[model samples]
Target: MISAQNIIKTYGNKTKKTQILNNISLTIADRSFTVILGASGSGKSTLLNILSGLERPDSGSIRYADTDITFLSDSQLTEFRKEKIGFVFQQYYLLPNMTAEQNIRMGADLAGNPDYRETIRAVGLENERKKYPDELSGGEQQRVSIARALAKKPDFLFLDEPTGALDEKTGRQILAYIADIHQRCGVTMILVTHNQNIAEMADTVIRMNSGRIETEQKNQTKKTAYEIAW
Candidate 1:
């Protein structure tokens, strides 16, 4: 569902010209789970931001299904982003004032999508419905953030180190929950992480370096060891 070709991104003034991404190319299938693996400053987050339509490349093209988003207008891109993509960042960007359930409900409310009560249940947040962000644990807060993203019911889900802020055990729990959702919801997911073990659970693993795709691995996807012990 995602296709990117010969992408080049640069920052700083022309006189300085620090090249951040170098001729990156990639293709991802419909409903396929892909894990993007890279070390720090390897352009994983930049690629994700571009793919999610938050930013555009200077050259090359990005095609998500029928549209080449690189060429879309600002208004069009905003509409597409609201309707077709959901993001889970390293930091749980939940609003502190809103209750957990209310925070998620707001995403759907903004999109005019279906009510997300079921999605809240899917994220295991039904029990912590009325709690505010500060009232929840780190793991619980992250679960609420995930629920908020899924509540939009976007066509694609982009996760940028979704477990980066949590402890190892909590991270594992979150990753398992994410893997379970990938299998059960059939939500096309692209997970960006530095952990090789987490990449093993994906249908496709994309390794990138210096803003370009280094290599990719396709696995039998149907066989996964992650059981929903959460």
Candidate 2:
């Protein structure tokens, strides 16, 4: 489990401070699918960054199981993220020259998972493994991004607007793959998105407003990606 206590974050200097997160505290259960929902500048993304160990909180404590991650040094945090966290973003951050197989393999190397090809197949990239980023469609590229992250087999998978750039049908297809990965791998998945429809598929839904959590509730019956109302 990941726990945050009295989390607070800010930007800019002391004289011109802008609060991003305010005394946010929550617990993300292992293997649970959590969606962080909010509008622009609502601190949802900032909170995800902190939870994923990419950014630090100004005044708070974050614990991953028994370890206090809030106190870890930069290098230690980097190592922690490298070993335990995987990320997918709205933008496919694939290397321009690398094949899909090579890009996914790079993530696999971190965890020494040589059979990452299965992940490629999982995302329906078997035929496109030899293709480069430019050779694939927007949805295919995002699938490659997901496959790359899944290749690591991280304990936690963080996605920020994974389908924001795709068409409706393509977005649904990509989301289906993500949901499939979650079911098969049972990884702790956290997604940050502005779409209310996507929250129907989440085990836990957290809504943020103006740097604070507006509400958080557990879904008694989570819907599938196909069932989501777009």
Candidate 3:
């Protein structure tokens, strides 16, 4: 389980500081799909960054099981993230020169995971493995990005607006792939998005407003990606 206690984060100096997260505390169960839902500037993304160890909280403790990552040094946190966390963002940050297979391999190599092709197949990119980023559609590139992240076999997968750049159909398709991957791999998935429709697919939904958690709900019956009212 990932547990965070009293997380407080801010930007800028004391004179003109802007608080991003305010005393946020939450727990994410192992191998569960979680959604952080909020409008823009609601601090959902900042909270995700802290929870995933991409950023540190000014005053809080973030623990993954028994390990408290809040105290880790920069280099230690870097190694920790490299080993245990995978991330996908709205932007496909693939190297233009690399093939889909090669880009996925870059992540797999980090964890000595030679079965990177399996991730490609999991994301339904078997036929496009040799294709470069420029040759693929927006949705295909995002699939490649997801596959690349999964290739590392991380315990937790953090995605920020994974489908924000795509159209409705493409977004749904991407979400379906992500849902399938979570079910198959049992990876803890934490997704940050503003769309309430997307929250229906998660086991847990955390709603944030103005740097604070407005509500957190557990879905008694989770919906499939296709069932969500996107």
Give the winner by lDDT: 3
lDDT, candidate 2, 112-142, per-residue tens: 9998988888888999999999999999999
Clashes of 1: 0
| Alpha-carbon runs more than 4 Å astray in model 3 | none
Per-residue lDDT tens digits of candidate 3, residues 1-230?
Answer: 99999999999996899999999999999999999999999999999999989999999999998899999999999999989999998998998999999999999998789999888888889999999999999999999999888999999999999999999999999999999988988999999999999999999999999999999999999888789887
Question: After TM-score superposition, what is the CA distance of residue 113 in candidate 3 from its true location, in Å?
Answer: 0.4
Q: List the lowest-lDDT window of 10 residues for candidate 2.
A: 173-182
Global lDDT for candidate 1? 0.86
* TM-score for each candidate, following the candidate numbering: 0.93, 0.97, 0.97
Q: Clashing pairs in model 3? A: none
Candidate 1 clashes between residue pairs 3 or more apart in a chain or in different chains:
none
* Candidate 1 vs 3: which has more TM-score: 3
Better-scoring candidate (lDDT), 2 or 3: 3
lDDT to native, each model: 0.86, 0.93, 0.94
